[model samples]
Target: MGTDNRIQTIEESTVYGLYHHGELIYVGCTTLALKRRLCFHRSDASKGNDAPIYGYIRKHVDAPKEDLEIRALDYDTEAAALQDLGHKTLNAQAADGAEYEGYDWTSEEIDVLEEESLNEASKRLDASFNQCRRAAMKLGLIDGDGAYTRVDWSVWDEALGTMSDPKLAEKIGCSVANVNERRRAKGIEAYQSRLSDDKVRAIWTRYHALEEATYASVAECFNVSKGTVARIIRKETYQDVERPPRITIEVAKRYHAQKDKSTDKGRILA
Candidate 1:
């Protein structure tokens, strides 16, 4: 970043103002969709986000929802007229009953905490995600349940033996350590590249000579992606290696003379 020239205020939705007990906690200017902007704050509020606004909120009630009312601040001609009842949790200096001082939570705060997620709670409490997560877990707010997709180990075994663990992990959405662990568990050894550049070039030449060869097919044979094949072709590193365009299905059928005999439409020759 030379000067962070990115545009702000995208003329989209945004927060006009945030209110707690009719007092302005924080103000935001945005260009995101109003619904989306509101959703973001509502979501963060629900998650316990620790951004300055939520931190300000934590001082008063530990949760914003109790005295919190989300309204378009533009509707109020003189918002200052709304009473600031001086709720103690809203008291910036009060450390005795606030989350900043002790773990003990007010019933209103606890109610908010229970309603919102750990991430939201963390925001309200101005604590870490882990801190909120642990508290939520302890409080039985979260029911541990996750659906996991099963990987095809048979296909993985084939690829694992030919490709790097990191590559396999990228393809499988698993960690490199997990890939290694799985390999070890399955008694499969780590992959070692035996082919030299010359050998690879030779394979590429031979594969292109065959009628069935295509970028995707060749890439699969070479244990790489199609882009790698395309890049090698573009570099012209393999001179006089004729990489022909893929045969269209229509062209193939016409060349083979598979005529639609029911109609008088006969095949054409190259």
Candidate 2:
């Protein structure tokens, strides 16, 4: 895994260090953006990779990522930092012959996108709900008596317990806080997906039989992405699971509706 004893540098390469409580613990160089590189480290750490940095993060999983500071250094400083930090820095070796890569997007960017989306949604709702209501009435999206656009609360009932507030909001085109408020109001618990063989079969069964059981809704129900549900339905994955026989959509709908109602009742009672 060693390069030809030559340090490789990208056109806009960055040398960065990971610090814990003001002490440097890791050193590396990347052609990628700083945040993007950190995101990759975080992903690898979550996947239980064998790297020392990953092990450190896994051991301190309860601590917020901010506690592990990422600070950029001058291009010429990689060797000095690695030497100064010695074995305490989690580098296998210095940047000699190291290859760095760049990416256009990272998980951190996705989180920023979600937060920005929620902020924009809240702003629109606060500033223009009444105005949009009038516009919607003229466009006939709502009747005259409706002063504001009302979400079909029934549609969200099935989704509340299955997915996180952010996911539910993204799926239903609302703010995370708004989805959270509605869920808490009804005494629904937060989303925590529990996947297993039995759960996979249940997801497949419902999607195949229920007309209202869309990939998005079913994914929400199982706390997975819509793509995951689609892959399961299309047999791209989970090929060993036995496919259940198709049933009437009406019967499926009735069963699901009753199940959701019962689940909601249980939550409220609890």
Candidate 3:
């Protein structure tokens, strides 16, 4: 997924040392505003958010606010600190506890699992944080009280895997031939290509935008080849972007603002 334009630099004081039961469980280094991230953790814990680490904290400990200690870890590079923590987490062994026995934190067998867990955590944090900021612009908080909406695609490409291209075309009110042509313009081989959730969300959002204004309109607005817009809408090729459920309008605004800034700064292009 693409990074947001609102990216902030991390300082030494921003790194946080995390401990469980007075023992170091992990160290988290982030470029997100410290106060914001901490608040997110607390709010997420209350809402049972879908973050692996947050879920782990909620499940393994009671009163995580009190049990899980957050201390400052001075580091020149927060990313490096996070990497070190991952390596340490992969190397450390867990001992039997009053609540559980033979807890192996660093089992070679589960190394892949640990790595996947860490990567998921990173992705979740980035997405959630961006969505929260966007929501805050229009809504005070991200709420789960909205109606559910699904996007369907119509055109299908064998290379893209198993996506229903015809259904997508029907949903978007476009011809399958047009969809396929757009995909070809974007060099997209299939409709159901393996893509990250973020990319899927971006494609959906873009497609919806095009639907609101028509494909030609969106192509003109983005100043890209019509085929590019069509391919994106058709999911021929996916672009990574953050997607958070129950995201607020404020967060969306922030996301757009960041995207615009990135484009202007040559950090990203449509």
Order the numbered candidates by lDDT, best leading: 2, 1, 3
Clashes of 3: 20
- 5-36 per-residue lDDT for model 3 (tens digits): 22211111355666677676555554344444
Tens-digit lDDT track of model 2 for 139-233: 23333331112468788776775777777776675546668777666645456642555777788877876666799999888888897788778
Q: Which residue ranges in model 2 land beyond 4 Å of their true spot? A: 1-10, 75-77, 97-270
CA deviation > 4 Å runs, candidate 1: 1-15, 32-36, 45-48, 73-270
**Among these predicted structures, which one has the highest TM-score?**
2
CA lDDT scores, all candidates in order: 0.48, 0.61, 0.46
Q: Please state the error at residue 113 of candidate 1 in Å.
A: 36
Instruction: Please identify model 3 stretches exceeding 4 Å from their true place.
Output: 1-13, 30-36, 88-270
